[model samples]
Target: MKSKGPPGGGLVYSTESGRMCPGCRQPVAACVCARQPARPAGDGVARVSRTTAGRGGKVVTLVRGLPLDDAALAALGKQLRTACGSGGTVRDGSIEIQGDHLERVMAWLQAQGHAVRRVGG
Candidate 1:
């Protein structure tokens, strides 16, 4: 009796009993598919400032030079907002927290091992 083939007309086989490698299924641990560690980037600084725009001249904190990628910057912005207990957003590689949180945000960023600077009034 002829054995039934796989859906793509290929032979069906199981590697449940050491028939294949658990890492890359190449039957060897020295396979080129080994996992590599990610390189780390040094800590990045953030600049804080207060701006009056589109809000009847109300004060808003602007954070720039966070030196993080899009995803990392978003996460950092969320943390900063929570710490400041206010609303904020990440735009154009910068973070804008509502209200004037210059001192608060500066201290927080420094505590997180980031060098912060005050920019603008």
Candidate 2:
């Protein structure tokens, strides 16, 4: 499918401004895109669950339904990993901690005043 271009179909880069924002055609550093609020990915409640479906019987605790932006999500994921003393990564708006820490995660999130729910067996 043919995609629409930016307003006026302006240049995406300039020697004077470096890279431009495709949405605004302004220099990335001054683009209004950065100031816009991200659309929430889920309900306000955060869900904690454990799954061993992908790995070879390895367990990972998945936290989903957070309404935070990438930066805040990364920070929250880091704190959760540290509190659980495990390593993990945040991807696709979900936090994947490297072990089964559902209880720990739920408790910690509750302590942090987040509305948390458990999912899966």
Candidate 3:
């Protein structure tokens, strides 16, 4: 089939942007179909847990099922990290704070009016 042009340029690569989006023929940053993950309406509860499964012997506190949009979730993650005096990242709609600050996180979430449920011991 003859592919459309201009908006649907379908260029595999772009000189100006280095890499262009196939769907919108624009730079990835400006593309209409931004590669954001499908937003999940989580299972109706904010869950907190601690795990040391993958990080050698270091512990990390994980918070999942937050019902915030990307921007808000990132901002909330920053706030939580700051509050916990630790470092963290927001990934796949969840926050991972470095260290086992589960109690502190639950308190902070409750202060922020979220119904937090502790998942693991």
Q: For this target, which candidate reaches the highest TM-score against the unseen true structure?
A: 3
Clashing pairs in 2: none
The residue-by-residue lDDT of candidate 1 on 1-121, one tens digit each, is 5646534343233464333434454544444566555333434657688999777987889888766777998999999999999998987778889988899999999999988878775
RMSD of each: 8.7, 6.9, 7.2
Q: How close is candidate 3 to the true structure, as a TM-score?
A: 0.71
lDDT of each: 0.76, 0.91, 0.88
- Per-residue lDDT tens digits for candidate 3, residues 4-81, read 664545576767777777776678778888766587878757899999998899999999998888899999999999
Clashing pairs counted in every model:
0, 0, 0
Best of the two (1, 2) by lDDT: 2
Model 3 alpha-carbon drift over 4 Å, by segment: 1-37
Worst 10 residues of 3 by lDDT: 3-12
Clashing pairs for predicted structure model 3, backbone only: none
Which ranking of candidates, highest TM-score first? 3, 2, 1
What candidate 1 gets wrong by more than 4 Å, as runs, is 1-43
* Consecutive 10-residue window with the lowest summed lDDT within model 1: 5-14
Q: Taking the tens digit of each residue's C-alpha lDDT, what string does model 2 give over 1-121?
A: 5557666577878999898998777899999977956556788899999998878999999999999989999999999999999999998889999998999999999999999999888
